[model samples]
Target: MLKISEVCCEDEYDSMKNYEKTPVLMKRAPFWSGAAVQNAKLVNISMKDFINKYMVLIFYPYDFTIVCPSELIQFSDRFEEFQDLDSELIAVSTDSQYTHLAWTTTPRQNGGLGGMNIPILSDKNHRISKRYGVLDEELGVPHKAIFIIDNKQILRHVSTSDMAISRSVDEVLRVIKACQFVDKYGNVCPMRSPCDDDTCESKNTKDND
Candidate 1:
């Protein structure tokens, strides 16, 4: 079996100094808005609009970079899996929306993003990255970070990595499934216990669907 990825508390809640961890855990996620390019269209979107849905905010360093494009395209390819599980996935970068569209429209053979199914949000001003605590101040780009917000708008999980490391799409899927399982059954998920694992009685039966 593949090992599940581990996330650090510091990476998850770096901005929560002087506050109780419990309260911080229950606090609503910070609100944000920016232009996004999705399915070859540009539009305005906000975090508030995704209320009542599981929201995954993926923060990467930049567009037109090697590691970033693979991650974005992977997530875009598996986007419907998130939707099927009642979640929304959004990719955020400091790149402008116009750049996002250009990259998506560019052919993959030319080392471009070809096509992207999910929204790629523009955080060109870095406000959202700063608020999320993923900004690399010296570099003016965010660290590789993933924030999973539950239906109530409470942030449930967060993971961050340095530029050299890439995140696992499979691991992210397992996490959201675990979150949903716990939310439905009120049972705790042990470490490495994926929702589909037979050992976990809390596993959802409909998971095979």
Candidate 2:
């Protein structure tokens, strides 16, 4: 197995066409996840499973890295916050399950995931990351990508950022809240949304600017 410092070679799936893909409702996402046993423990992570709720997928390039750990821990820290909003968060990368397990067992002070229980999907072949169009062929890793899938499994929001910058978990939650708000009220959610949450107030200022 290759270590984190080793760069990956370019492969067949290095096309830009797959990025920002919009999936049809009830369609199964093209990837396998969960603990990788000898047979690869694939989860039934279909669009149908998350009905009447929301789904958030964060795609990072590799595991046991700097920005990645910070982002994953933050999501794990706020896992219940997402749950409270009837949403699920799934983190993915091009690393294998064994790699994920090793990293998760490592502590945050040691630059690891600090034993986060959030489902970290393994895409060792970059098949899933490429299908979602988050892979970076040059670096052989996925981009800092965040995707919001609605309860019906339709791909609603897709955005990417530099790997050097860690994403704001609060921003992600705010967007999901807005998505939910729109679904229920059928009107645009104000940037501030009248919510008393600290994230709401701070994010609103940025939203307006």
Candidate 3:
């Protein structure tokens, strides 16, 4: 997997830096006692499933939309990579489970994500999205938001982008790995490399006027 620096361009890196510092409160992942897609019964999806495990929570704009399917399929194709890192992928939208099932059952040629192993959580009431501050009240759909929650249920990383742009799956995996590295080593990250001359290393480093 590519490092976070390679995955994100300079502008994206600056944006992510600001985003990381923003104080946005995230609600705990909901425990839903509802039916999963394809007639699979689900009592609830708890934080425990992700507590000790790395997790990627993806909140899309909406289902059955123009850009949604492409992003979904891209994530599905790389799902194994996430699994290799011992992370669970939970995709959420305001769409109902019936809609999720229909989309999953539909062929990829027909713009549906066929046979996706990742769990698609329903936020039909907008409760979850609202809690995450991704809900677009006017459109009633979620904006593109991704959260990397560590094993302890603490919000480690959060990002939201325009509805049009699809997120980088590789970068998401990298962040998860970085977070896991931090968790294991306490402070130092194996992937944190020395800054180059052009990069600022301290808060006191001033840009040349």
Whole-model lDDT per candidate: 0.80, 0.68, 0.66
Candidate 3 residues 102-143, lDDT tens each? 888877788777778788888787756665667888999888
Candidate 1 residue-wise lDDT, 36-149, digit = tens: 998889999876567678899999887888888888889999999999988999999999999999999999888789888889999998878877878887999888989998
- Candidate 3, position 69, lDDT: 81
What TM-score, over all chains together, does every model reach?
A: 0.82, 0.73, 0.72
Candidate 1 stretches greater than 4 Å from native: 1-23, 191-194, 197-209
Clashes of 1: 0
RMSD of 2: 10.3
Lowest lDDT sum, 10 consecutive residues, model 2, at 1-10
Residue pairs with backbone atoms closer than 3 Å in model 2 (clashes): none
Error of 1 at 110 (Å): 0.9
| Cα lDDT, model 1, residue 97 | 95
The candidate that wins on TM-score is 1
Candidate order (lDDT): 1, 2, 3
Q: How far is candidate 3 from the true structure (C-alpha RMSD, Å)?
A: 11.4
* Deviating ranges (above 4 Å) for candidate 2: 1-51, 194-209
